[model samples]
Target: MTSRHHNLQHLKNQAYQDPLTGLPNRRSLGDYLQTALDRLHRHAGQAVVMFCDLNRFKEMNDTYGHTVGDRLLVAITKRLQAALRPDDVLVRFAGDEFVVVLEQCGSRQQALAMAHRLKKQVGSTLHVDTAVLQPRISIGIAMTSDPLTAAADLLHQADLAMYRAKRQKGDSVEIYDPVLDD
Candidate 1:
């Protein structure tokens, strides 16, 4: 490829990727989710936005220092990516938080199933460098029928559900239910 083409590709990579995890950043999540929503609208499918957070990484950072924490983040990212379908979109939202876009789930149960898988994968402990770290992810899920629902709103709903999960004792995944909106 031409140097100019390479440079542009590099730039796009930087724009879409998280500096730490090398996963797609939230900058790309909006566009991807919007496109998925549009496709769902056309084909009569369902789309879900999942808010993911790695629990207790801050405590790890405090005990092990930032460098280990960074390595742990990368390892955690690897586990998350490995747990997902090849076509799924994963984003590093901040610190240890991630967002996943799941396409074409027929019902909230199906979406919840994916969420359960994610919770299981992320909740498992993995060895990072010299330290053995167990990181659990709390998930928030939002399902939409219409393309018109704002992307930010969908994310917000998922985030709220994730927070709800966090409030429960262990690794948890909660779907956005309007009644639970808080």
Candidate 2:
């Protein structure tokens, strides 16, 4: 490739990727969701959107410095990536929140299983330098096969589900239901 082409590609990557976690940023998530919606519209395939929030993240940040918090975030990112399939897309939404897009997810059960796997992986103890920290996450899942569903709607549903999970006793996962919409 030409030097100019390479530079442009690098710039595009930087624009879409989170600097700390190296996961896709929100902008990239929006674009990818649009494509996923279009594909679902065409093929009537199932896709799942998962919203994850770290529990007690602010407390962790307050106890440790941002430097340590940043390292913890990176560690969590690696675990998330490892838990997902190659085709699944993980986006660093903001701060301690992440969005995972699972394309061609066969069913809600499959998505829920994936969420459990991620929650288990993230809930493990993390060691940074001499400090050991236990991380917990609440996950919300929204599965869609409808062509008419909007990306924002899906995200909102997932967000609400995540909040519901957070309210529970431990690191939990909740699937979005019609009741959540109301």
Candidate 3:
């Protein structure tokens, strides 16, 4: 049946998504980020790439079944989306990692504020299914003032900042090392 086909397609899309969170997988994140970067470049504007990794996900996952973990991820994803501005994007990069893009950010301050908001959102306790989930996200902000920075480079910068964020706690948001080689 036609309805069956539509359902199947939807299922297929979900399969590529993070089963735990129902957010786009890293594979799709790469594609979408690239597309956004390209569009920004064409428009001669800056793009802000942010990487978010949950702080206490592994502890929760080991303590609970994947079902509970998945539910928690879903709740976290919704919270992140709700916190983002209309022009920004939030993606599930991986297990506890997420990627966000702020199109045409006017300043580092703007990016900083977004990261702080995301950190607060993720840090909030969530009621997922039958349990409460506590988690925080470390945010990494990468801003490219140059319109020519390719998508791959933008991702690389965001990833580097993500590691910097992981070194600490609560809410760490670091700008990319502009001095680094491209």
Clashes of each: 0, 0, 0
lDDT, candidate 3, 17-130, per-residue tens: 776666677767766676666776567556889988887788888887777887777878898998988867777877778899887777788788888888887777787666
* Candidate 1 lDDT over residue span 34-129, tens digit each: 877887767776788999888887898898889999998888788778878876788898888899887676888888888888877766667766
What clash count does candidate 3 reach? Answer: 0
* TM-score of every prediction relative to native: 0.92, 0.92, 0.82
Sort the candidates on lDDT, descending order: 2, 1, 3
Model 2 gets an lDDT of 0.88
Instruction: Point to the candidate with the largest lDDT.
Output: 2
What is the Cα root-mean-square deviation between model 3 and the actual structure? Answer: 2.9
What are the runs in model 2 whose C-alpha is more than 4 Å off? Answer: 1-4, 42-44
> Which candidate comes out best when scored by TM-score?
2
TM-score of 1: 0.92
How many backbone clashes can be found in candidate 1? 0
Candidate 1, 24: how far from true, in Å?
1.0
lDDT of each: 0.84, 0.88, 0.78
Indicate the TM-score of model 2.
Answer: 0.92
Report clash pairs, candidate 2: none
**Which residue pairs come into collision in candidate 3?**
none
